[model samples]
Target: MRKYLILGILLLGSMFSYANVSIRSMETELVAVGISHESIKEAENILNIALKKHRIMLIELEQKELEVNKLLIEDPEKNWFQINRLLDEIGQINANIKKNQLKAQIDVRKFISKDDFLKAIELHQMNLGVIK
Candidate 1:
């Protein structure tokens, strides 16, 4: 369990590092593809706000997950109820993160053109090597 938690933390750390790069790459690609300055700025503002909120939620989620792991390691039998409660909180945070991401995407789509938005997505995937 400890090993799993350490691995999860490492994976999440790497993902967060990649997320920062990905956001900047997307912004640069949007400009390179001739997306309007106004649209880019608007989309960037929306995304930044969402990203800020997401970072908070992710930190909370990570802390709660760590707490649960601690409880489990210390005394799974004695801390059963607390462990379950923390697990529930983690689930709720995960759900909220998903909802927040969807809302941000919808908000961004309103400010950016469909074609431009798709182009940015394609460029992002290409950067990740997800597309040939």
Candidate 2:
């Protein structure tokens, strides 16, 4: 049936769009944390591993979001049901993103102290400014 085929195509497209948006949002948040380059790389590596493990969960959330969108579009009367489902999926994704962000923050903090340690040594060697 051509109608069924068209529906399936739309569904898949929506799912992919949702997933890509989520991924981009997560990456943007990570970039905003202001970590050093070395620390950023390390955080990225850890995130990559965690994302691989949770790939399926992410995909499922995207699919749910897509379904909610479809439902909302089909009939204005079903807006509340679709909205509630979308909110739940958004919450789950937010939780996952927050968890990963905290992990990355911890990793970045570890490097910050080390960087400060090296800077102190450099300052001492140069006899620059007043040593505390």
Candidate 3:
């Protein structure tokens, strides 16, 4: 979880730095590409909900990280047990975040056809410099 969390946070943090993409922009592109309005709307709704959940979880994680950091700073060598308990809480929070993110992706996919998904991926790659 720690390994993935490192990667995930890095990706999430740097995502906006790489592109000005938003769910609304994707919705517009989907509509422009002839995807049905209803399908695009549904997908956008799912994405928005997922993003909100992800944001909340990120804030929670940051708060928990601060608590852990403070504990380490205050006790340094005498809070091993409390530090472990905080680590367990962090683990649980990360698991919940992973679950919510996956569920959101699953729900979004239900409304987007395979070709549309591919197009979105391609656009993402182009915007994020994955493809030059």
Candidate 4:
């Protein structure tokens, strides 16, 4: 019984880990769109630099959320007030992640043609279907 419980926990953890990928897959999408390898490398390099700040913020956000969850679990009554604040923080983090993603998209687009960008979008949609 304990082994089964541990397996279930590990499976769920792996699922969540896959859910968080954004940048790496996008790079592959670039290659799928027939983007030049040199261009992809250059664009990815620039985008990666731009993403470092946003990535740090996201990491901090994740840490804070985990801490908040831990607090709520350990002491439900006292942690009630923290819920609203944490929710707000989470909302802000989500918005910032979106913003950063948009910025990265634009940065990569600058290195590729408009047609390639459109192709990438189509490929991304197809990948969503296939991945699920």
Candidate 5:
């Protein structure tokens, strides 16, 4: 259980960080790659909407985690039902996060070429501290 919690936190952190960086630098990188202004605007709008949803989900996820931790600390055996429910809620939130991410990707792809989109992603990854 502890390991799963740690892994979930790691995944969420990495994913949100990537999204944050993409929104931060997408315009400049896209422009550098010769993406048109209208396309860049459309892509950014998609990302912004997704990012807002992600932010809310992240907060809710953290709150649920806290609730689960509290239950475990107070009484694992007695709180089994509540803990399991929270776990399910967490799973649903994760699923929604992935869905939102995929939707954002699809929406952005509608207006941006594959190469330019990939370049933006690569740049965002670099911003996230990739070696090069």
Candidate 6:
């Protein structure tokens, strides 16, 4: 009984670990591609309808993982073969999202150049009566 309980805990932990690792990897990839938080936020807001779109995509990915889990349990013999394919497709989608996110970030960075950022700060100060 103890052995079974330990195995169950390990399995549950692994599932969460896999999901977290996938998300972290994607985030790292986006950061490595020179994407910034501000740019990603802007892209999520403007390029997509809103941040909700990104959330929906993440939820869909999680749903696909759940489907994979169900398939594995319901018909391991038949579904086992397809698991790799599904995972591959999911990975590709993640990569695509990362690429698109990086592109959007780059576009946002271009739209707001260094000088523009400085000017915007100055303008804000002027509006706040901090500067003449």
lDDT digits (tens) for residues 1-132 of candidate 3:
556876887676444322224545665556655678798778667766766776777888878878888988999678888888888988888888778767766776687766886787677567778899
The TM-score, computed over Cα atoms with residue i paired to residue i, of candidate 4 is 0.52
Candidate 3 displacement at residue 19 in angstroms: 11
After TM-score superposition, the amount by which residue 103's alpha carbon in candidate 2 deviates from its true location, in angstroms, is: 1.6
Ranking, TM-score, top scorer first: 5, 3, 1, 4, 6, 2
Off by more than 4 A, model 1:
1-35, 119-132
The C-alpha TM-scores of every prediction are 0.67, 0.41, 0.70, 0.52, 0.71, 0.47
For residues 41-73, what per-residue lDDT tens digits would candidate 2 score against the true structure? 554565455545355545765677677667778
Error of 4 at 119 (Å): 7.1
Better of 3 and 6 by TM-score: 3
**Model 1, position 104: C-alpha lDDT score:** 73
33: Cα error in model 6, Å: 26
lDDT (Cα, tens digit) per residue for candidate 4, span 43-66: 757666655755576576667677
| TM match of model 3 to true structure | 0.70
Give the TM-score comparing model 5 with the true structure, all chains together. Answer: 0.71
How do all the candidates rank in terms of lDDT, highest first?
Answer: 5, 1, 3, 4, 2, 6
Positional deviation of residue 38's Cα in model 2 after best superposition, in angstroms: 15
Q: Please report how far candidate 1 places residue 18 from its true position, in Å.
A: 7.3
Against the true structure, whose lDDT is highest? 5
Report the number of the highest-TM-score candidate: 5
Q: Which of candidates 2 and 5 reaches a greater TM-score? A: 5
Per model, state how many residue pairs clash.
0, 0, 0, 0, 0, 0
Clash pairs (backbone) in predicted model 1: none
Q: How well does candidate 6 score on lDDT at residue 80?
A: 78
Candidate 2: which stretches are off by over 4 Å? Answer: 1-45, 53-58, 107-132
lDDT, candidates in the order shown: 0.74, 0.53, 0.71, 0.65, 0.79, 0.53
lDDT of 5 by residue, 10-116 (tens): 68657756755664567776777778888777767787778788778878988998999899999999999999999999999989988888888788788887887
Better of 1 and 2 by lDDT: 1
